[model samples]
Target: MRQGLGTQLRHLIDLLDGAVSAAYEEAGIDYRPRYTPVMRALEGGEPRTVSQIAEAAGITQPAATQTVTLMMKQGLLEASPGVRDARQKIVRLSAQGEALLPQLRLCWQATRAAADSLDRDMPYPLSDALAEAIAALQTQSFGARIRAARATTKSKKETS
Candidate 1:
């Protein structure tokens, strides 16, 4: 039997992230794949609010908040009051996170080369496919597609 699309996508993510996680472990870096986006967002050395981080990282605010909270707990990020908004928390890399830059840069370079090699082996690049898929979903969401299919099914049933 063929695997479902969701299952296959999950398996792909697991395989990719598992290898990435192992790479960090082997390099003696205690970081998670999820943290990379937020780190990238804050790597510019400018403090930004959670909404700004979310926008910069191409992630949802809630996801950014969760990641920022976790990173803060791990001492990789520091949060302070936004300049004009006392309730808004501006986030930036902590000293520890700054210290990891050189190591992470090396790891990122290696990961990029490995990804290039992987793309060369395949007919279609995974990164391109991901971008295309994201674009398609932005055009017509999965829920919309499912609802259209459901309507067609109902029409077929009514015709019968």
Candidate 2:
């Protein structure tokens, strides 16, 4: 059977992330591609809540929270309670994360160039397809589609 869309999407991400991770490993940098967004969000020493980071990084809240937690464990990030909202925690890049920026920036540039090269060779660029898919999903989410399919299945079963 053909692979599902989610499986294929994950495979693509794994392939890209693995290549980037391997490059970082060769350069003696302990970094993951997932760290890039969080690092970019915390650039310039700005303190932001997890939600703010999610918005800045264009990722979901849970993803930002998990990445922030992992980064903290790796000593790449620090968190403190917000001044205005004690319940809210603000996250900032650690000194170590800042120190790694120059190397990371170089890798980021190389990665972008690599991605562009990959896109150029493809008839339908992955980046463009992903962006368009996201825009379409924003209009009609996958969750809605899944629920609709489920309802159809249930209705058919009920009539039988």
Candidate 3:
């Protein structure tokens, strides 16, 4: 049997992320591809709350929290309590993180160029396909689609 869609998507992501991670390693940078979203979110040098980080990074709060914690452990970021909401954590890049920007910026530019080349070679632009998929999912979630499929399968089985 052919591999499922989820598996295929995961394999694609692993291939891309692995290559990006290897490039960072080749550059002697101790950074992960997963860190890119968070780093970009904080690149403006504005201290933002975890919720703000999540929104800016286009990730969930829990994901943002997890990434922030990892970055902190790497000394790439620092966090302090929010001024108005003492419970909310405000995060910013540490000096160590700032130092990495020059190199990261170069890597990012190269990566973008590479992606553009890839999109040009493909039948459809990968970035456009991803955007359309995300928009469709927002309109009707994957779970809803799965449920509808299941209902159709169940009804067919009943007749059979």
Candidate 1 per-residue lDDT, tens place, 63-158, comes to: 999999999999999998877879999888999999998899898889899899998999999889989998999999999999999999999999
Q: Write the per-residue lDDT of candidate 3 for residues 1-160, one digit (tens) a residue.
A: 9999899999999999998999999999999998999999999999998899999999999999999999999999999988888899999999999999999999999899989999999999999999999999999999999999999999999999
**Count of clashes in candidate 2:** 0
Ranking by TM-score: 1, 3, 2
**Candidate 1 residue runs with Cα over 4 Å from true position:** none
Residues forming the 10-long window of minimal summed lDDT in candidate 2: 27-36
Higher-scoring candidate on TM-score, 2 or 3: 3
How many backbone clashes are present in model 3?
0
lDDT of 1: 0.93
Better of 1 and 2 by lDDT: 2
- How do these models rank on lDDT, best leading? 3, 2, 1
Off by over 4 Å in 2: 152-160
Per-residue lDDT, model 1, residue 117, is 93
Alpha carbon deviation, residue 65, candidate 3 (Å): 1.0
Task: State model 3's lDDT.
Answer: 0.95
